[model samples]
Structures are given as C-alpha cells and as structure tokens.
Target: MEVFEPFLAGIDNPDHRDRVEEIFNWVKTRFPNLMPKIAWNQPMFTDHDTFIIGFSVAKQHMAVAPEEAGIHRFSEEIVQAGYDHTKELMRIRWDRPMDFALLERMIEFNLLDKQDCSTFWRK
Candidate 1:
C-alpha cells in the first residue's frame, strides 16, 4: 500500500481511518494481483490498466465506486446486500458490515465485463 500511504495517512479519524484500511486490506488480500493506486483522491484497484473498483470515506458512510456499469449490473445485488447506491457509486453505511462477497461479485463482473476495454475507465 505504499502507493496509498499519503492518502491513508491523511485520514484523521481513527475509526474512519481503520475502516478504510480494512476495506483496502480486504480487497488487497482477496485479489493480490490487482494493482492498488490512489486516483481521484481515493483508493482504487485496477487490473490490466482498467479500473476494477474504488473506495472513499465520508462522514457517515463509505462509498464504493465500481464505476457506472458495475452499479447498473449489480443494482439488485447491492440492495440485497443491504447497501444503497447511486448510478455511479454504492453507499455502505459506516455502521454496517462490509460485504466482501458482494464486492467480489462486483469486481469479478467488472473484470469479465471490461475484459476488452481499451481504457482505464469506461466510456
């Protein structure tokens, strides 16, 4: 997580900071091959130069951005997993459990769905 040290170090709230690190570690441990980077001022994971997902922390919730397509594709699953979402990002309330399984599905879907993508982001 050397690439993310700057961002992580900036998080002043211990609980918020710890949770963000937990989410980062979960993704890193689960998918060791994915590259970790700080982009758009948040933590993001990529594979073959294409973004798989991203995470951000706010006052009341953590935001998960799997990009727009991932959200659209997993809308129902996000709800079933007990999360709220916008067209571009999912909201995981700070008080709720981090659904790693749901995250895995979204990452897997993005990997498959964006296999042929020619850019880091979707058009």
Candidate 2:
C-alpha cells in the first residue's frame, strides 16, 4: 500500500526502473494535480477522486490500464504495436518498453475527459 511501492517493487531491471520513473515524471509534469496511489497492489493515478490509470508488472510484461475511453481510443495502435489489450488495459512486454508518445496522449485525454460523478453516487 504505499502509493509508489508497487511500482518500485515491480521493476526488476534498473533500466526499466529508470524508464518508468522518466515516464512517471513526464506524466506528473502534464497532470500536476493528479494523485498517485496504490490500488490492487499496483501503481495508480487519480484525478477528481476518480482513478485515471494504473500499472502493474506481469510475468513477462508491464501492463497499464489507461482507463475508460482511452481503452477504445488506443486499441488499434496497441494491437498494431504488438501489445495485448484487455477491455480497459494494455500489456507491453518487458523487453519492449511502453510507447511514451502514446502513453502521454492517453493520459492527456483521460485528464480532459468529463466524468459522470453522479454515477458513483448512484452505485
């Protein structure tokens, strides 16, 4: 449960750790108000009290849940790039680090998307 513990724990390679940190820093620069938290034993980012994204380390890959509409928006590109796409997440092989450009775009889109907070109250 520490906010960044899982992220730090998941990194097995020093190079990957450095890359992840670089990407995290870039995201923080773009979304200064975003909060970092641990959820489901993974690293997550939130905004307006809603989880905007999450990342985990799998057996042979690193996975990121880009969240909501980001899933659909980046599905094709993810698949074309040889990454696996779940309903709301993408998993990239550790040997192949994430695409920083695509990740940045997805984060920006999620930050700008309007959320229906009322839905949270309804449920």
Candidate 3:
C-alpha cells in the first residue's frame, strides 16, 4: 500500500480513495508476487517487470486497464459484470459493485498469457 500512497493521496475524495485502496489491497494481497508501482500517474501491477494490470480514477468511474488482450478476452464477462469498456480498458462506475472474481480472472489470464512476453506490452 505504501507504493500507492502518493497516488491515493492525489484523490480529493476520501471515499473514492478508500474504494480504490480496497481494490489495490485486494489485488496486492491476492497476488503477493505482483510488483506494485505507479507509472504514468496510475497504479499498476507488473509481473517480472511486465505490466499485468493497471488502474486510474475518474470522476464518475474507476478505469481498469489490463491491457488489450485482457479486455478482448473478457469483453462478455465485463459487460455482464455491469461495466462498459473500450478496446484498452474497462470503466467501473463509482456506484457499481466491485467484481473481485472477474478481476482475479483478468489478472490470472494476464500473468499466464504474458509469461513469455519480452516487452512491457504485448508485441
């Protein structure tokens, strides 16, 4: 959590900060091997220095960026989970519930799919 304190501090709303922190802590605890860091002003997790997932905050929603492949692979479930998404990221509205199960799958998929990737992003 310390790695993300600076980023969390930037959020103006206490509730928003707590929500984001909860998600971050969940991921960090569930996947202890993932390295936590802030890059490009967003909180992201990487495996073996390769980006596994990332997150950003917006006024109406929190954006989950698990890379293009993660979005593509889970497009259906994403929609079913009550979120909307672009090609690169999914937006979970502030009023919506957190889907930890779906999040777990996305992270697991990325960890396995990118295990052999040699770049920060998929090539």
The CA lDDT of each predicted structure is 0.91, 0.73, 0.96
Candidate 3 residues 39-99, lDDT tens each? 8988999999899999999999999999999999999999999999999999999999999
- The best candidate in terms of TM-score: 3
Ranking by lDDT: 3, 1, 2
How many steric clashes does model 1 contain? 0
Q: Give the TM-score of candidate 1.
A: 0.94
Would you estimate the TM-scores of all the predictions? 0.94, 0.78, 0.98
Task: Kindly report the root-mean-square deviation of model 1 from the true structure over all alpha carbons.
Answer: 1.1
lDDT of 2 by residue, 62-99 (tens): 78887647889889888878888888789888788668
Off by over 4 Å in 3: none
- The deviation in Å at residue 104 for candidate 3 is 0.2
Which parts of model 2 have CA positions greater than 4 angstroms off?
115-123
Taking all chains together, the TM-score of candidate 2 against the true structure is 0.78
Model 1: how far residue 37 lies from native, Å:
0.8
> How many backbone clashes does every candidate have?
0, 0, 0
